[model samples]
Target chain A: MKMIAAQALVKALEHEEVTTVFGYPGAANAPIYDALSKSTIKHILTRHEQGAAHAASGYARVTRKVGVCMATSGPGATNLITGIATAYMDSIPLIAITGQVSSEMIGRDVFQEVDITGATAPFCKHNYLIKSAKDIPKVIREAFHIASTGRPGPVLIDVPIDLQLEEIDFQYSKGPDIRGYKPTYKGHALQIKKIVEAIAESARPVICAGGGVITSNATAELTELVEGLGIPVATTLMGIGAIPVPHPLCLGMLGSHGVRAANLAVAKSDLLIVIGARAGDRATGQTDKFARQAKIVHIDIDPAEIGKNLGTNIPVVGDAKIILQQLLNYVDEHYKEKHYKTQWISTITQWKNAKPTNNIKEDGNNEQYVNPKYALSVLSEVTKGETIVVTEVGQNQIWAANYYQTVYPGGFLTSGGLGTMGYGLPAAIGAKVGSPEKTVIAIAGDGSFQMSMQELGTMKQWDIHIKIILFNNYRLGMVRELQKMKYQMNYFAVTLEGSPDFVKLASAYDIPGEKITNNSKVKEALDRALSYQGPYLLEFIVDPEESTL
Target chain B: MAKHTLSVLVENHAGVLSRVAGLFSRRGFNIDSLAVGVTEDPNVSRMTIVVDGDDYTVEQVTKQLNKLIDVIKIRQLNPSDSVARELALIKVTANSSTRPEIIQIVDIFRAKIVDVSKNTLTIEMTGVADKIAAFEEMLKQFGIKEMVRTGMIAIERGNQVIKIGSSEESE
Candidate 1:
């Protein structure tokens, strides 16, 4: 059957089980929108192209599926850059579709014509500019395949407007088999055996988990491995949800902003079994000092990351979920009778007691001034079951990292590597779209929220009732804090000039919002906000002098 | 810092070079020389990258190159056992009096006079990067007008072929 190329794109999405897409339409992408309108898939019309890309990334990060987003030519495609780069830095699987000028006009620099695939080439995992209408089906399939496999990142497809209008003989079942792109899922048996021997010999073994564990959906395997061996698990910021923070063997996030206990766990260990984590600078502090005492065994799908940051004694390159299972099997077969170290557990317990993960002491005795940490702690408590907490970068993000107890996999979503501001709101919107059954919250700061406050228009447009929790400190608190510590208190442009009344801002969107003044009223306000369904916003007036540790 | 030459086999694609270059930049390693060419297999491209660093840099660059989806294989060319060549074109500002001296330098280096203007002589030479640099340096005495260097390319001295299947040897 002959069908419009744009319609074939939509059918391809349907074949991939893409139930939702976040995008903004323009003249170049009008044909795609025309086709989208006829499909059962929900199309979210975001206020900005950036929001659409970010929302798609958020959905991908949460669901482990290739999230799809679309945009028009030129500025629209340029706007998607930051979001695409953000996803790329964090290794989130995303498919970004951008409309181009007519094929004849692409290089002519016609109005709204930009080589998006070329522009995004440096950052994206792969990119393509569709040359013919006949290639649409296979190209779309290839885009999805490349986006979701082999340590996933964003893949872009640039469709010229003329190509969208062109008709093609439809064959929905046909897909491209990428011969060169085979991702290794199984670990070498020799490597697994070596790890088992290393584990048996190790008196103080620490499991360092990163986002790859979560990316591979290996949370259960990771938890079981740690539990069975009676080993303490320390997580990178991206690996926050791999194990419950409250668990005894679980050390909280490690590195600069990470708790001392987790950092100490890595530093003191005789054997560091690093799984899925890239061992970034922030996570390692000083590279030489990071797990120097340990025989580091790095496991990741990307072989490049194995010895990138720290020296690896044994490198296992494969899918984390499968490798973890294989290692678990090896451990069970050989070390079933072996007993885990008691002294190691006791030492970890001492460290845990020394530096507790959740001690939010209310320093502000005043009824009006709210402590950000205390506010976040209470908010964490009031929100009951199956809540996905997404946070903007900086102090609010760190505070959330410290206070929020992630009990489930994919429960916590934040921009880890890029540390991009204005990520939370759009990401929360995407997360909510992906998992409509769960309660999603976007935790933002006074500075970060305004960066993409325009996204409130998207929330209002879709009637997306995502709980917006803004920690209003009236300043770029993290920057100010950094200046005070690093630059001898020479404060410059960190303060927010004439802060917007977020309550009124939400009101402008016709959503119920409130400003919390007192720490005592945080719970009541959060309770009220969480109860009223459709996009309630709450602003916590946090102490400006106070900063996240 | 030790200088190492790496032979990287990659899928022939537009963005593969950019990704390889980007990875080096992100890691703060500068490429001393880079030469890319299509292999016998049209789908494969051979990249001869000369990087400057210690053992760590070679390890980092090799491992990172392998990780890229486009990169198929990588081999470090041992300078003693490999044939490396670089091409350089030099345009010298030569007059009737100075032409003989420039020609003498070219003849000594086995270089070719590719182009000539009334006042300029363009000489082309192929050798190891060091020899090309020396040839260019000698030509500079006659006031060189313009110059270009094609980074370095290498092949093993023996019968071993650098193909798609060669990467399995690393494993």
Candidate 2:
């Protein structure tokens, strides 16, 4: 059958099971928009191109699939750069399609002509400029495949206006046939055996989980391994939901904002088994001092990630599930009657017991405003494991990371690498869409939420059920905290003055909102917001003096 | 530490080179040299990078590279049997005082002067690592001021093509 390149793009996305796309219409990409209108795919018209890209990122992060975004050439395409880079940095899967000037005018510096392919080359996993209509289907399919597989990132396909307008015979193939894009999934047997050997020989071992564990859906296998070996498991911020928070062997989060016990365990362990984690700087805290006492064993699907940071005595390159399963089998065969160190477990238990308490001091006369940390603790207690919590960047993110208890995999979503503000609401909308059965909550700081407060319209438009808990300290709380710690508390531009009433703003978007100042009213307000939520916002005027971590 | 070859697939765009190169520079990863070009897919560009570090450090560098938004795929190529090539255009002073000596040096190195003006001559050379280093070192004496290198482009020896099909089939 004969088809146009723009039509092929839509067909390719359908094959990839992409149902919805976020984008803005433009002159350069009107042909694509025209083609899309005839297809079954739903196109969400975003107010801005940046919103479209970020919305796509949110969708991809929640669905664990390739999120699609579209924009026009020149300025429209350039606007998607930040969102594309955000997804790139965090390893989120996204496919961005941009409209380009005609092939004839590509290098002539004609009107609306920018070398978009060259502009986006470094930030995307792979990108293509469709010079021919015949290349459209293949390029689109490959772009999705490359973006969603292996380490998973954003890919771009720039379709020229002429190509989009040109018609060609289109055939949707079963799969791609590129010769250079090989990615290994199965674990190497030798590497698995070596990892088993390391596990068996170690006296004190701890399993460190990262975001990749969740990405690969290896949580169950990881849980089985940890339980069987009595290994204490600690997670990075991105790795929060890899193991159940209530599990006996779980050490919660590790790093600067991680639990004290978890950090202590990581520091003192004799052997560290890192699974699907790159051991990023935030998680390692002074690299030279991190795990100074431990021998590391790193397992990751991306071979490049093995031993990238801390030295790994055993490097197993493959998917986490495959590697863990192999290790489990190897251990079962070789160490059936192996002895575990009872003394080491007792020592860890002792360390756990010695950890400092998080009890909030309640002096009846000392009430000024709500402490953000205390408020988060309260939210944690009330929400427990029922709600999926999304956090904006900065102090609120740190507070959520340190205090929020996620009980299952895929429960917590945040902007980790780029730490983009205003990510909470839109991402929460996407998370809710992905897991419609769950109650989604967005915990955002006043400064951060305002950055993306425009997305409240998206939530309202989609009728998404999200409980937004805005910690309104009227400042960039995290920066202020940093200044307090290192900059002698001389506040700079971090403070906010006469900020818009978030409650009024939410009302303007046709969403219900409430303002809470007293600590005592937080639970009541949260309950009210959670109970009748199409998309509800609760602004908590938090104490500026409170530290998030 | 030994140097290793890393092949990275990235979106073909501007500033991506700087971002990737900047990362290595900032992280203290000694990149021996690097090259980037459009792949079979016009949207994708391949980067051939040579960096010096231990296995762990190299792994770390690749992981960081993977974290980059534009870097879609990265693979560590085997050092043996990989055809590595680099192109350099060096403009040196070629006044009557130094023209003949420079030409003789270029002839000895089998380098071609692609461009020439009154007082300057641009020599283009391509070779393996040692020869390029020697050629550059020799030209330094002729008051070489400007040099542009096409980093390094490489492919594995044999008829095998590192295409999309191989990558997908392996997965």
- Model 2 gets an lDDT of 0.80
Residue by residue across A522-549, what tens digits does model 2's lDDT show? 7787778877847788888877877766
Chain A TM-scores of each predicted structure, in the order given, are 0.97, 0.95
The sequence of per-residue lDDT tens digits that candidate 1 reaches over residues A127-200 is 88888989898888888888888899999999999999999997865455665566778988899999988988
Interface RMSD, in order shown: 2.6, 6.0
Error of 1 at B138 (Å): 4.3
Candidate 1 local Cα displacement, residue A99, angstroms: 1.2
Write model 1 residue lDDT over B30-143, tens digit each, in one string. 799899999888998899999999988888888767766678778898899899998988898999999998899889999999998899999999999778878877877789
Docking class of 1: acceptable
Q: Where does model 1 exceed 4 Å of error?
A: A172-175, A333-337, A359-364, B13-27, B92-108, B113-122, B137-143, B165-171
Error of 1 at A186 (Å): 2.2
- Per-residue lDDT of A224 in model 1: 83
